[model samples]
Every structure is written in C-alpha cells, then in structure tokens.
Target: MKIARREAWTGRVLLLVLMAATLMPFLSLLVTALHPSGSYPLGLEWPDDPQWGNFATAFTAARMTELLKSSVLIVLGVVPISLVVATMAGFAIGHLRIPGRRFVFLAFALGLTLPFEGIITPLYYLVRDMGVLNTRWAIILPLIGLFMPFSVFWMRAHFVNMPEELSESARIDGAGTWQLFWRVHVPLAAPATSSLAILLFLWTWNQFLLAIVLVDDPLQRTMSGALGAFQGQWGTDIPLLCAGSLLILTPTLTVFLIFQRRFVTALLQGSLKG
Candidate 1:
C-alpha cells in the first residue's frame, strides 16, 4: 500500500509537470497578447492596462470574416471528397479480390511518402495549365489528393480487421457489392470514418503551405495566409499577431473539443473491437 501510494504521488507530480510544460507557451502568448503596444513595459510586472482590443484590430486587419469563409468552404469541399475517395479505395483494397490488389494498395500507400514540396512546383504548372490557379478548387483538389493516402491506409486497416463474416453474410443475403459496401461495410466502419473525418478536417483547416503557394490574391486566401498578410502590415504589433494566431487556432481547437469524446470512443472501438 505504501509503494502504491508513492507511485500515485509520482504519477501526479509527473502529470503536473507535463501540464505546465505544455501550457507555458500558450500562457506566454496570452501574456504577450495582453501587453501594451509600442514596447514591453519596463520591469517584469503584469501590464497595468492589457490591450484586449488587439484582437479586434487583428480581426479587422486580417479580414478574418472573409478568410474564415474561404477556409470553411475549402474544408467543406475537401473533407467529403477525401473521405469518399479514401473510403472507396480502402474498401476495395481490403475486400475486393482483384488481381494485383497488393500492388495497387502499395501504389496508393506510396502517396504517403511523396512530400508536397517535391510536387508543388509541378502541381503549380499543372494547375496553371488547367487554368485553375488562384481558384478555391486549386487548393481543394490538391488537398484531397494529398490527404487521401493516409485516409485510405487507415480505413483499409480498419476494414481488413473487421469480421469477414459480416461481409460474407451480407453477400449471402443477395446484396450486390455496392449495396454491401454502402449499406453494410460503410455503416460498420463508422468509427474509422469518424476518426478519419476529424483528422481530415483538422489537416484541411490548418493547411498553410498549399494555401500560400496556390493562392495569390489575399481575398481568396485562408485564415493562415491572411494572417501572413496581417503580419506584413503590422509586424511590430506582437499582440495583434498573437491575437490573430489565437483566432486562427480557434476552429480546430473547438472542433476537437466538441468531438473529442466521440473521437476517443470511436478510436478505441475501432482499434479494439474491429
């Protein structure tokens, strides 16, 4: 009992330390955001007057409303396309007994290794040639392609681990392949789908590089890209920059916080039961 008590105390101490380490940067950013503009006031004392209006200033300068709308539209477009394509590809690879299935699976999985940097130059030319450059579709289309590999790989593993009996039974009931996939396998693959959706949403939402390279017009850019423009305009204003960063981070954080319970439950169920 004494040893167990000691172990529990040690665990609590470790958790406290970890929490502080994780929170310190965010705390520092908040402190900086509240600090008065011009210069850090002399002495280490907290600001006598915190500049909370920096947030509003950042919002207005960044044109956050329009940027957010662009981001939302991109995410909405990318998530469904990525999920659908990845699901179909994963399901086929997992269940369909096609010739050279393993080779095809490997080919798709190789996409995970192809870094965006290597492809961006070529992709830019391709988009330009296709006359889609600077359009929202340019960003959305590439994102769907780039994110599909991991999604397919994850969903394929989940589907493969699922009971073959379930699918076999559906086939025995005279369900067509499409019906079995859509009505049966897809429904049972909910946990994997949910997990993938959360991941894709986060990825697509926070995507910066693609947004920067593909989008030229500030009006068409995302929150992150808009923040870059904001920085260019107000680089010296650390408070405003931090405020913009916080605003940019809000959607992804809110999403995870809201769906976190479901995400955790789904992940555990898919991993352990499927």
Candidate 2:
C-alpha cells in the first residue's frame, strides 16, 4: 500500500510538470503582451504598466473586425456543409451493404493523405475561373472539400463502431435508412459530431496557407491571413503582434475549453472501440 501511494504521488507530480511545460509558451506570451512598451532595464519584467490598449491597437490596425467576420462566414458555410455531406457519406459507407463500398471507403480515406499544396495550382485556376479568387467563398468552398475527408473518415469510424443490432432493431420497427440515420445514429453520434466540429473549426480558423494562396483582398481574408498582413505592416510591434495572435486564438480556445470534456470522452471512446 505504501509503495502504491508513493507511485501515485510521483505520477501526479510528473503530470503537473508536463502540464506546466505545455502551458509555458502561452503564459510567456500573455506576460509579454501585457508588458508595457518601456517598462524594464532592457524592456523585460512583470509589466510595471500593463498595456491593455495593445489589444485595441492590434484590432484596429489589423482590421480584425472584418477579418473576424470573414472567418465566421467561412466557418458557418463550411462546417454545416462538411458535416452534412460527410455524415451522409459516412452513413452510406459504414452502414449500407452496397457494392464497391470498400473501394469508396478507401478512396475517401485517401483524401486524408492528400496535401493542399499538391492541389493548390489546379484549385487556384478553378477558383479563378469561377471568379472567386479574392472572395470569401474561395476559401469556404475549398475548406469544405478539404475538411470532408477527415470528417467522413471520423464519422464512418464512429458509425461502424455502433452495434449492428441498433440498426437491425430500428429496421424491424419499420424505420427506413434515412430515418435510422437521422433519428437514431445521428443523435447517438453527438459526441463524435461535436468533437469533429471543434477540430474543423480549429482547422478552418487557423488556416493560413489556403487563405494566403486563395485570398488577396485584405477585407476578404480570415484572421490568420489578416495576421500575416498585420505582421507585414507592423513587424516590429511585438506587443501588437502578440495581442493579435491572442485575439485570433480566443474563439478556437473558447470552443475547445467549452467542449473539452466531450472531446476527450469521444476521442477516448472512439480509440477504445477502434
């Protein structure tokens, strides 16, 4: 018993140490962001005069309001489209006893390995032809396509893990395929759905490469793309840059924190089942 107690205590100590190490950079950034412009011997100390105004300055200078609106529009458009299309595809591939299902599943899974860079040139020409190169839809449309692969893969895994009896029982009660999926499977897959939503939101929110390649207009750019512009304009303003990064991070962090428990539980459950 004594040995076991000591081992547990050591485990707790190790966990705490790991958590601190992971959080150190964020804490340092927070401190630096708050630090006054000229408050130290070499400008490094606990802020003698915390400059909360840096956040405001960053927001205004970066035109964060418009950038934020663009991000919201992209997320709103992409998430639901990705979810609905992926969910349907997952349900079909996982539950339906269709011919060529395995081939379809393999093709969909391959999407996860496809890098955006490889397709960017073609995608650019396609979007350019559609006259969406500098529009918010340019980013939104490609994101939906790029994000669907993983979303379908994840939802398919969850659907495959669900007991066959659930669908069998529903079918016995005269429930059609679509009804079974919408009424029963979808509700049961809430945790996984929520988890995927959080992940896709983060991916779309922090998307820089696609945004930069697709969008040229500052007003149409997402927060990440706008941050690049901000960096270009105010590269020497460390506090402002930090503040802008923090702001850009706020929504994704908040969503993660809010659904953290559900995310962890779903991930662990999926892992165990798989």
Candidate 3:
C-alpha cells in the first residue's frame, strides 16, 4: 500500500512538472502581451501596468479580421472536399478492396514521407506557371492535395479495422453500396469523420509554407502564413506580436477544445469492444 501510494504521488508530481513546463511559454506570452505594447518585455515577469488593449491593437493593425476570413474560406474549401474525397477513397481501399488499392495506398504512404519543404519549390513554380500566384486558389488547391494522404490514411485505418460483420449485416438487409455507405457505415463513421474534419481544419488553418510561397497577399494566406508578414511589420513590438500570435492560435485551439471529446472517441473507437 505504501509503495503504491508513493508511486502515485511521484507520478502526479512528474505530471505537474510536465504541465508547468508545457504551459510556461504560453504563460510568458500572456504576461508579455499584457505589458505595454511599445516596450519589450521578456521572461515571466508581470507588467507594472498591463496593457489589455494590446489584443485590440494587434487585431486592427494586423488586419486579423481579413486574415481570419481568409482562413475560414480556405479551411472550408480544403476540409470538406478533402473529407469527401478521403472518405470515399478510404472506403474504396479499406472496405471495397478496389483493384490497385494497395499500390495506391503505397503511393500515399510515400507521400507521407515527403514534407512540404521538399516539394514546395517545384510546387511554387507549378503554381506560377499556372498563373494563379497571389490567388486564394494557390493556397486552397495545394492544401487539398497535401492533406489527402493523411486524411485518407486516417479514414482507411478506421474502415479497415471496422467489423466486417456490420457491413455484412447491412448488406443482409438489402442495402446497396450507396445505402450501406450512407445509412450504415457513415453513421458508424461519424466519430472518425468528425475527428478527420478537426485535424484537416487545424492543418488548413495552420498552413504556412505553401501559403507563404504560393500566395502573395496576406488576405489570401492562412492565418499562420500571414503571421510572417505581420511579424515583419510589428516584430519589434513584443506585446503586439504575442497578441497576434495568440490570435492566430485562437481558432485552432477553440476547435480542438470543442471537438477534443469526439477526437478521442474516434481514436479509441475500434480499439476495444466495450
């Protein structure tokens, strides 16, 4: 009993330390953001007078309203279409066992190994040659393609691991492929689909490299991509930068918080029976 209690206490202490370590940077940023906008503050020290208006100042100056709108449009464009394509492709590969699926899945596996930095240069020229540079489509189209591998991989994992009995039973009820997918499989896939949407949403919102490389206008780039330009203009202002950083971080965090339950449920859905 004493040993178990001691181990429990030790684990709690370790987790507490890890939590503090993780939160320390955000704490510092929050403190710095509250400090006077013009002054450079460092460390975790609190300001003598907190400038609460730094957020507002950052919002207006960085044109975050427009940035956020652009981000929403980009996310909408990328995530839904990506989800539909990924879900269909994943179903075909995982459930239908389409011919050449293994080969195609292998290709996506290769895609996972290729990072944005590795492909961004050629992609930039490709976009330029297509004459869509500085346009929203520059960000939108590439992101859909870029997000495909992981999204399809994620959905495929769920579908592949799903009980074949469920599909068989659905077919026993005279369900066609479309009916099985829409009425039976899809309902079962809700958790995974929502989780995929959340991931794609976060990825699309945080897309930086392609946005910076392909699109010229800040209003056309993801929030994270536009942060570079924002930094260039206001990098000297630590408080404003912190505030802007928080603003950029807000949507993704909010989304994760809201869907975190569904995300965890999706991840664990096929892992156990009860």
Candidate 4:
C-alpha cells in the first residue's frame, strides 16, 4: 500500500512537471505578445500595462482577416468531404470485408508511411499540370488526398472494433449496406467520427508546407502558411508575431477545449467497445 501510494504521488508530480514544461513557452509567448508593441518584451515577465493593441496590429498587419477566411474555407472543404470518403472506405474495408481487404488496407497503411516531404516535389508538378498552380484548389485537392490514409485508418479502427451483433442485428432487420452505414452504424460511430473530424480539422487548419509551396498568394494560403511570408515581412515585430500566431491557434484551441471530452470519449469508446 505504501509503495503504491508513493508511486501515485511520483507519477502525479512527474505529470505536473511535464505539463509546466510544455506550457511555459506558450505562457512566455502570451506575455511577450501582450507587452507594449514598441518595448522589447523578453523573458516571462508580465508587462505592467498589457498591449491589447498588439492583437489589432497583428490582425491588420498580418492580414489575418483574409488568412483566417482562407483557412476556414479550406477546413470547411476538407473536413466534411474527407470524413465522408474515409467513413465509406473504412466501413467497406472494415465492416464489409470485401475481396482483397488486406491488400486495400495494406495500401492505405503504406500511404501512412509515405511522408509529405517525399512526394511534395512530384505533387507540385502534378498540381501544376492540373492547372491549379496558385489557386485555392491547389491547397484543397492535395490536402484531401493526403488526409485520406490516416482518416481511413482511424475510422476503420473504430468500425472494425465495433461489435458484430450491431451489424448482424441491423442486417436481420433488412438493413442494406448504405442503410446500415447511414441509419444504424453512424449513430453508434458518432464518437469516432467526432474525433476524426477534430483531427482532420487540426491537420487542415495548420497545413503549412503544402499551402506555402502550392499557393504563393498569402491570401490564398492557410493561416499557418501565410504566417511564413507574413513573418518575413514582420519578423522583427515580436509582439505582433506572437499575437498573430495565437489568433491562428484560437479556433483550434477553442474546438479542442469545447470538444475535448468527445475526443477522449472517442478513444475510450474505441478501446472499451473493442
């Protein structure tokens, strides 16, 4: 009993330490951002009078208005569409167990191993050839494709882990494939789907490399992508830079905080159900 209690305290202390280490930089960034613009803000010192204008300056100077819009549009395009496709593919591979299911799943597994850096060059030329070049489609199309493998893998994990009785019961009740997916499985799959949507939303929103390489116009790129060029122009403005970064991060953070429970539920649901 003593040993177990000691271990629990040690673990809790270790976790707290880790959390502080992780959050320290972000706290420093927030402090730096709130420091009056012209003044040099350093260390973790809190400014006496916080520079709220830094946000406004950051918003306008960074062209956050347009960048935020582009990110929203891109995410809105990517998440739902990707979810639909991945869910369908996952259900087919996971639930249906169609012919060559192993091969199909293997192909997707291989795709997970294929990093963006490896194929980025070819992808550039491919997008150019498709005549999308600097357009928003340039960012949107590739993201959907790149997002597929992992999305499929995630949803498939959930579907495969689901109880056979659910599907069997539905089938006996005259549920066809589409009917099973739409009416029966989908409701039960909500936790997994919500989790997948959050992951997709994060990936799509923070998409940087492809957005930067594919779309030259900052206005057309993801907020994180636009930040690269925006940084070049305002690199010296530390407060503004920090402010813009936080703004870009806000939506994701908000979503995560709001739906963090669902995210946890997804994992638990997947694990316990399996």
Candidate 5:
C-alpha cells in the first residue's frame, strides 16, 4: 500500500510539472499581449492597463478574414482527398492483401522518412512548372502528397489490426469488395477515422513552412503562414505580434478541445489493438 501511494504521488507530481511546462509559454504570450502594443515588457510582467484592443488591431492589420478563407479552402482541398485516398490505399494494402502489398507498403513507409524541408526545393520548382505556384493549390496539393505516407500508415494500422473474422463473415454474406469495405469495415473504423481527421485538420491548419514556401501570396497562405508577413511588418510591435499569434492559434485550440475525447478514445483503441 505504501509503495502504491508513493508511486501515485510521484505520478501526480510529474503530471503537474508537465502541465505547467505546457502552459507556461502560452501564459507568457497572453501576458505579453496584454501589454501596450510596441512596448517590450520584460517576461511575464502584467501591465497596469491591459490593451485588449490589440487583438482587433492585429486582426484588421493582418487581414485575418482573407487568411481564414484561404486556410479553409486549402484544408477543404487537402483533408477530404487525403482521407479518401489514404483510406482506400490502406484498405487495399492492409485488409485485402493485394499482390505487391509488401512493396507498396514499403514505398509508403519510405515516404515517412522523407522530410518536407528536404523536398521543398524540388517541390517548389515542380509547382512553378505546373503554373500553380501562387495559387491555393500550391499549398493544397503538396500537403495532400506530403500527408499521404503518415495518413496511409495510420489508416493501415487500424485496418491491419481489425479482426479477420469480420471480413470472413461479410464475405459469407455475399458482400462485394466495395460493400465489404464501405458497409462492414468503414463503420467500425469510425473512431480511428475521426481521430485521423482531427489530426489532419490540425496539421493542415498549423502548416507554416509549406504554406509560406509554396504560395507567394500572403493572402493565399494559411493563417500561421501569414505570420511571417505579419511579423515582417510588425515584428517590433511585440504585444500586437503576440495578439495576432494568439488569434491564429485559437481555432486549432478550439478544435482540439472539442474533439479531445474522441482523439483520446482513438489513441486508446489503437494502443489496445497493438
């Protein structure tokens, strides 16, 4: 009993320390943002008079409305196509065990090792040649392709671990391949799929490097990508910069909070299956 109590206390203390570590930066940012715009307050100093309007100023100056629209357009283009392609590929490779599955899966596994930064230069020339350099498609297309290795791998993990008994029963009932996948397995894969969607959403939304590099137009870049331009123009205005950052971070944070339960459930399910 004493050992168990000591271990429990240790866990609690560790969790508290981790939680503080995670939150401290955000707290610092918020405090800094509340200071007067253009004033560089020392770390974690609270202003005598908080500047709440800095958010509005940052929003207007950065043209967040347009950035939000572009982000939505890019995400819409990327996420659905990624989900469909990754799911189908996963199903074919994992559950169906198609000929050359090993080679194909190995190909995707290799893709996982290829970092985006390493490919960005070639990707830039490719997009430039395709005449989509400044368009939202620049960001959207590369993101879908960049995401495939991990996305397919994630869905494959779920499908591969699914019980073969389910497939056998569906086949016995005269279900075709399409029907078996759509009717029998897809529904059962909801938790995994939803969690994957959330992750894709967050990744696409927070994507900065690809967004800034591929698309030249700041208006067409993701919100986080636009931060580069925003900083260039207002970098000296520390409070306003922080305010804009908080604004950019808000949607992703809201999404994680809303789907946190589903996300946790999917992780637990995957761990159990593994």
Candidate 6:
C-alpha cells in the first residue's frame, strides 16, 4: 500500500511538472504581449497598464483575415486528399495483403527517414521546372507527398490489428472489395480517421518551412509562414510581434483543444489493440 501511494504521488508530481513546462512559455507570451508596443518587457512581468489593443493592431497590420483564408484553403487542399490516399494505401497493404506489399511498405518506411530539409533544395528545382513555384499548389502538392509515409504507417497500424473475422464476415456477405472497405472497415475506423484528419489539419495549417520557401508572397503563405514577414516588419516591436505570434497560434490551439478527446481516444485504442 505504501509503495502504491508513493508511485501515485510520483506520477502526479511528474504530470504537474510537465504541465507547467508546457504552459510556461505561453504564459510568458501572453504577459509580454500585454505590454505597451515598442516597450521591452523582461520575462513574465505584467504591465502596470496593459495594452489590450495590441492584438487588434497586430491583426490589422498582419492582415490576419487574409492569412486565415489562405491557411484554410491550403489545409482543405492538403488534408482530405492525404487522408484518402493514405487510407487506401493502408487498406491495401494491411487488409488486402496485395502482391509485393512488403516491398511497398518497406519503401514507405524508408521514406519516413527522408527529412524535409534534405528534400527542399531538390524540391525547389522540381517545383520551378513544373512552374508551380510561388503558388498554393507548390505548398499543397509537396505537403501531401511529404505527409504520406507517416499517414500510411499510422493507418496501416490500425487496419492490420483489426480482427480478420470482420473481413471474413464481410466476404461471407458477398461484399466486393469496395463494399467491404466502405461498408465494413471504414465505419469502424472513424476514430482513427478523425484523429488523423485533425493531425493533418494541424500540420498543413502550421507548415512554415515549405510555405516560406515555395511561396514568396506573404499573403499566399500559411499563417505561420507569414510570421517571417510579420517579424521582418515588426521584430523590434516585441509586444506586437508576440501578439501576432499568438494570433497565428490560436487556430491550432483551438483545434487541438476541441478534438483532443478524440485524439486521446484514438491513441488509447491503438495502444490497447497493439
């Protein structure tokens, strides 16, 4: 009993420490953002007179409305297509056991190690040759491809662990390949797919390196990507910069908070099955 109590206390303490570590930076940013523009505030000091209008100023100056639209469009373009392709590939490899599936899975596994920075230079030239540089397609297309390996791996993990009895029963129902996947498996995979969609949405929305490198126009870049331009113009104004940074970060935070339950559920489901 004493040992169990000690372990419980240890876990609680660790969780509290981790929670503080995660939230401290955000707290500091909020505190710093409330300071008067062009006035340097050290650390997490609360201002005597907080400048709440800084957020509005940052929003107007950064043209956040347009950035929001661009981000939405880019996410819409990337996430759905990625989910579809990754799910299909995973189904084939995990459920169907298509010919040469081992080799195909190996290829995707190798692709998982290919770092984004390593491919950027070659990607630049390829996009330039294709004449899609400086456009949304440049960001959209590459992100879909870049995301595939991990996405497919995630889905494959879920599908491979699913009971073979389910597939056998579906086949006994005279269901063809498409019907079996669509009717039987897809519904059961909702938690997995929804969680995957949330992650893809976050990744696509926050894609900065690709957005900055491929798209020159600040207006065309993802919200995080536009941080480069926003910082360039206002780097010296610490408070405004922090405000803009928070503005850019809000959507992602909101998304994660709203769907965190589903995400946690999916993760637990996978772990339990595994």
Q: Estimate each model's TM-score.
A: 0.92, 0.93, 0.95, 0.95, 0.98, 0.98
Q: Candidate 2 overall Cα lDDT vs. reference?
A: 0.85
- List, residue by residue over 1-274, the lDDT tens digit for candidate 4: 9999999999999999999998887888899999877567769999899898899899888878788889989998899999999999999899888999999999999999989999999999999999999988999999999999999999899888777898899899998889999998888788888999999998888899999899999999998899899789878878878888888888888999999999998888777866
Question: Runs in model 1 with CA error above 4 Å?
Answer: 41-45, 270-274
For candidate 3, list the clashing residue pairs, or say none: none
Clash count, candidate 6: 0
Q: What's the candidate order when arranged by decreasing lDDT? A: 6, 5, 4, 3, 2, 1
lDDT of 6 by residue, 1-274 (tens): 9999999999999999999999999998899999999999998889999999999999999999999999999999999999999999999999899999999999999999999999999999999999999999999999999999999998998899888898899899899999999998899889999999999999999899999999999999899999999999999999999999999999999999999999999999999988
Query: For all candidates, what are the clash counts?
Result: 0, 0, 0, 0, 0, 0
- Which lDDT value does model 4 have at 182? 97
lDDT of 5 by residue, 1-274 (tens): 9999999999999999999999999999999999998899998989999999999999999999999998899889999999999999999998999999999999999999999889999999999999999899999999999899999999999999888899999899999999999999899888988999999999999999988898878999999999999999999999999999999999999999999999999999989988
Model 5 reaches what TM-score against the true structure?
A: 0.98
C-alpha-based local distance difference test score of model 4: 0.90
Q: Considering every candidate listed, which one attains the maximal lDDT? A: 6
Residue 234 lDDT in candidate 5: 98
Report residue 240 deviation for candidate 2 (angstroms).
1.3
Model 2, C-alpha of 177: deviation from truth (Å) = 1.7
Instruction: Please give the lDDT score at residue 54 for candidate 1.
Output: 75
Q: How many residue pairs in model 3 have overlapping backbones?
A: 0
